[model samples]
Target: MRNSLRFKVALFFSVLTIALLLAQALGVRALAEAQEERLIAALIRDDMTNVLKGYQANPALLPPFDVRMNGYVSGADRESVALPATVRNLPFGTHEIIIDEREIHVAIAPMGTAGTARLYRVYDFNIYEKHFKEVINALMGGTGIFALLTIWLSFGLSGLLVRQVAGLARQVKTLRLGESAPIQPGKYDETELAGLVEAFNDYHQRMAGMIAREKAFTGNVSHELRTPLTTIKTSCELLEQDAAIRGKSRARLQQIERAADNMRELANALLMLAREDSACEVEPVAMAKMIETALTPFADRLAQKGLQTTIDIDGDLHVMANRPALAIVLSNLVDNAVRHTDRGGLHFRYAEGWLSIEDTGPGIPAHAIPHVFDRFYQAGSPDASPAGVGIGLSIVRKLCERYGWPIEIGSEPGQGTRVSLRLPAASRT
Candidate 1:
């Protein structure tokens, strides 16, 4: 919660409110105290004048006295009157002093010949000072309450501020490529929010157009390429029946047919991968049969290398997968293993839902194993295989990702490599 924008906004408002209220509370207290002091000073001045007049008329007259006010007079000699040392020598003016820890405001006035006689009036309004403090404390308490309320309201306001952004995030999260309509900017009233929505809409349209163009290009290219391949395979079959094509000639014809078949498979795989809506129907596929079919093109190379082969899978074990996609994945893996292995055999094993292919080839380096599935990242030597453009494992990974299959590779420098696939488990055939 502290990391959220709403929380930060609320905290900002809370701090600002508290600071403003505290400053206002202090200002009000200072003003009230200053005004009280001025009022006391003014009353003292009036009392001084009255004391001078009363002494002139009656000679022994004293000034008024109350819980909040006091009066004193001094003789012309200044020593005849018993005045506090702090105020005795103060000139004929009002002055404030602390006498016995109590605040006092003293006012002095002159009268009689040569202004020798002086009237001193001191006022103590500590009682009212205490009440003033109580009022200030109450004001501060009220300010605190208001600040807290403002903080709570700020949290609610922040939620309203981010509501549109949260809604937009939900829409983007659920959006599917080339399936959903563009987000409408008109729904948002704020100019910045509307502009943001419009930008996203533009991006969505561009991505959809690019995907459509890619599907069209792949589809067209694959169609155009496969036509010639199909014709060549048909022509090879017709020639194989003729007695004139024998021995080496028949062998060459068979190789040509196999090449055409492999090319057609490549085109189909590329086409399926390029289209966004190319989800194929899944069914129970015989894993052993599919493996044998994938290895057919590599048979000659396997024989030439004198490499042994082991298939430790149950013939009746079937897996749930798209036939064409699984075929391509198997073919790529088999081709990679065959081209690299010179003296050792290829081993296939199945357990539970996982099918693993272990090869006795010069194993991939530990450092290079991580990038073996990356496109165009050749882990073998340049002369390893003519068709090793480094895209085989990349395609296998992509198909497995699309179909939710799990694939992993483990290898050591001299111990060969093992590639594992976690396919959907099906009932035994």
Candidate 2:
């Protein structure tokens, strides 16, 4: 809750409002107290004047007056009046005193000739203190109510703003080329928010259009290339059957056949990748058979390099995957292994739900391992053999990701490299 924007805004507003209210309350209380003191002083002065005039007219009228007021004749030693020493020494003017926890306002004046007697009017301020307490209580109560209202308003407004931002974030997160609709500007009232929505919508549309165009281009190109690739493969097969062909011509024809077959496989893989839909059907495939099919195109090169290959899997062991995509993945791994290994062999192992391909090639550098699966990212030294473009592992990674297979690569310098893929348990079952 503390991390929430709404909570922070509300807390800030509440604190600011409470501080302002407290300051205003103190200022108002001070002003009221000052005005009340002046009013009390004026009333006390007028009442004292009246009492002095009454006493001069008739001395008997001074003893019994308003009970809230106490009159004292200084120098007469009136012991029943209960005046404090501070009030007794005060010069002839209005002053304040506290006696027995009760605040009193005192007014003094000359009562007779040549300082013979002095008149004192004392007014108890306990009633005024009670009233002041009531006022303070009311002010505090109102301040609390206003503070609560301010907090509620701040939270409500901040929540509305945060929700709008969250909505925008959710839209962006779920945005996909053909799956999500573009954001509508009219949904937002604020000018800046509307502008942002419109801008995102424009960018989204452009990106979706570009993707569609690229997919169509790739599909069309792959379709066009397949015809010639099949024709070339057929021609190579026919030429290899001819008895007139010599050793060099036959080898060249065989190379052409392998190249055409590789191109066809690559085209099929690219076509599969370019399609956005992932509704391809998966079926049980024998692990050994899949490995054998992948290794066929590289058999001549592997043999020429004097490299032995091993497949360690029970013939009954199988996995479930889309045939073409999985074939592309395996073929790419095998091709990379054959191209890079100078004199060592290839090994494939399948156990439970894990498949591993280890190659005795100069291992990938530590720095290059992280980027090995990036498109067109070649590993190893700069002087390494340029047998294949760097997309082989990238294709392998993509296929693994699409099928929800986890892949890991480990390598050590001059020791070789190992690639492991963990398929779903359901695939093995």
Candidate 3:
């Protein structure tokens, strides 16, 4: 029963009431007894002296038989106590007697002859006893009623306080992490509880800001994709209008084919971003060995452009990654580096779980650096003579982000550029 708050509160107040009532009861009993004793002593002593003085002044006015003066005495059964041989009357030393058939304290003394000059002192406690009993009954009843009222109020007040706290806690439990919830106000005083409620409202507003940013990121990507798609569709329609399949005009058809391929590649890159949870199968690939294999396809182009290639690859550095993803990312970076370099030389390094592509090329401009990662955003205009879609960095960014690897881009315009890839160091189970 003590586990419940109402029971505990009620018990506490009940115990407090009992203690106060007990102290009051003891004080009342002692005070009533003392006051009665003092009152009885004063009345009995004064009467004993006065009656003895009256008897001393008149000696012949006494009765022969022993009797109570001016009043008849009675026993406990409301009958008369037999008069003794001597009138052991009032004013005697403290003793017992019958008065009105009730036994009571009495004292007697004589001032003149044996029968005359008598006096009495009486301390009958009957009246005080009756008065004390009535007071006891009234006090016990009043104290009991007060104790009951206090217990009821304690349970009601404490239960109300506990109920409000429990309700607020249940509501807080329903709130979700990273998601905002509507605040339902609970019963509370205009105190510390108000501050806590305002804090929750502030947190809900901050969550709204994060939700808005995620929405904007998605909207921007969709707007960027629309432009390149329209350009590819128009170029394809232009090629289909002509019927000649031979001569220098064939390059027009080839250009259309290349644009279509580029658009398909860009679409696939966007698909990769959309499906980040798509799992890919993997196997070991030696860095120095795979770069040698991949660079073979671009050799002819390098030769035609009167360019030189330098490969300074260390021993076989094994890395685990999806072959297709690594091929697209590495090929795109290398191709872009080679295309933009006027010196026509490509350099490579494979060291410490990383592969770097460095080219002796006129590097990217400084002002365009920040926007390089934006989709379909190419750096340098026709004046600096840079080519290709601006999405190579976007692909690299998405692939590196999805794979949880690190990518670094560093360039000095008119000097050279370096693109570094750091693969995740695999953990052993």
Candidate 4:
């Protein structure tokens, strides 16, 4: 959740709001405190000036004494108006000092006709300071509450900000390979968001055009190749009927026929892959019968290599699947086993909807196992012998994926290889 865009946006807003609010609170507090201090200091200075002038004009006139204000002059009834030691040493200026554990602001000025004696005017500001602090505390408390409210509002605002983006993502998820319609840019109100949707629509149209071209190319090529393949098969059949074609000549002719059949199957498989959906008809296929038919193509190769073969599938075992797709899968698996295994045998077994092919070939390398199903990926160095252009397993994987079948391959360096397919079970015929 922390990695989500909404979460990140909310966090960004939260940090920004906190910083702005804290700065605002501090700035207001400092400004208010400075203004109050300046006003209080000016009042003290004015009171001191008035008292000094009155005593200067009339030597007998005494300074006013009040609860919030008091005046005292040095060398004039010094014993009766006792001054604090801290106040007596003060120069002619305004000063703040503690008197009897209370805060006092004092303004000292010159007094007497000779301008030698100092006059001190004291103002006790403890009560006013207490009230000022109370007001500041309430302001700070309100600011704190407002800050929390702003943080909550930030989450809601962030969600609104990204709602269109989230909706775009949901639309993208619903898109199919080539069948989905483009998102309408007019749906979004923001210019940037509308532009983004337009860009996506352009990209989607380009991809769909490419897919259409590829499908057309594959369909045409497959259709065109079938003609030559059919002609070759028919010619081979006519040549085989003639008794003059014997021994090596007859065997070569058979090879040509087999090659033509394999070519046709390959073209069909490629055509099927190019289409968005399979065109092959689905039916209940007898597992053992399909295995026997698939082994026919590689029978000569197995005999040439002197390798054995075994089948342990029940005659009645059947699976619900597309026949041609399953045929291509089994043909590829058997062909791979035959190509690799030169010494030992091949085993085929079926149980609980899983059909497995076990080969005694020198097993695939552990590091290469993961990539065996990738298109055009072969084990060993480039200088080594090639392995059928490496599309056999890739085709099988694609077919299995298209049909929602589960397939797996397991092998060790020299312990042989095993490929398994879990098919949909059907009632025995």
The candidate that achieves the highest lDDT relative to the unseen native structure? 4
TM-score attained by model 3: 0.41
In model 1, pairs of residues that clash are none
Worst 10 residues of 1 by lDDT: 63-72
Candidate 3 wrong stretches, greater than 4 Å: 1-247, 250-257, 279-282, 292-297, 382-386, 424-429
TM-score of each: 0.63, 0.64, 0.41, 0.63
Q: What is the C-alpha lDDT of each candidate?
A: 0.80, 0.78, 0.66, 0.82
Q: In angstroms, how far off is 379's CA in candidate 1? A: 3.3
Residues 1-429, model 1: lDDT tens digits: 237777888788888878998999989989998998788776766666666777778865654322221334433222232457556567878876776787666667665666655566556677788888889889989998989898889898988987888788889998888678888888787899899999998999898899888878887897789889989999997998899888898888887887787678777777878765555678899989999898888888899899888889889888999888999999989988987788888999998779999999889988898899898898876675665567878889998988888999998877888999998778753
For model 1 the local lDDT of residue 109 reads 68
lDDT of 4 by residue, 1-429 (tens): 248788789889888887888898889889999999998987776766676777778867765432222335433222333346657666778787876677666677765566665566656677888998888898889888988887898889989999999998899899876676789988888899999999988888898899889978887897689999999999998998999999999988988997797788778778777776574567899999999999987888899899898999888888999988999999989988898888888999988778999999889988899999999998756797885778888989999988888999999877889999998779644
How many residue pairs clash in all the candidates, one count each?
0, 0, 18, 0
Reference-based TM-score, model 4: 0.63
- Summed over model 2, clashes come to 0
Misplaced by over 4 Å in model 4 are 1-11, 33-134, 148-189, 234-244, 278-293, 303-306, 310-327, 348-356, 365-387, 397-414, 420-429
Candidate number with the higher lDDT (3 or 4): 4
In angstroms, give how far residue 384 of model 4 lies from its true place: 8.0
TM-score of 2: 0.64
Better of 2 and 3 by TM-score: 2
> 148, model 2: CA deviation in Å?
3.8
Cα lDDT, model 2, residue 94: 75
- Candidate number achieving the greatest TM-score relative to the actual structure: 2
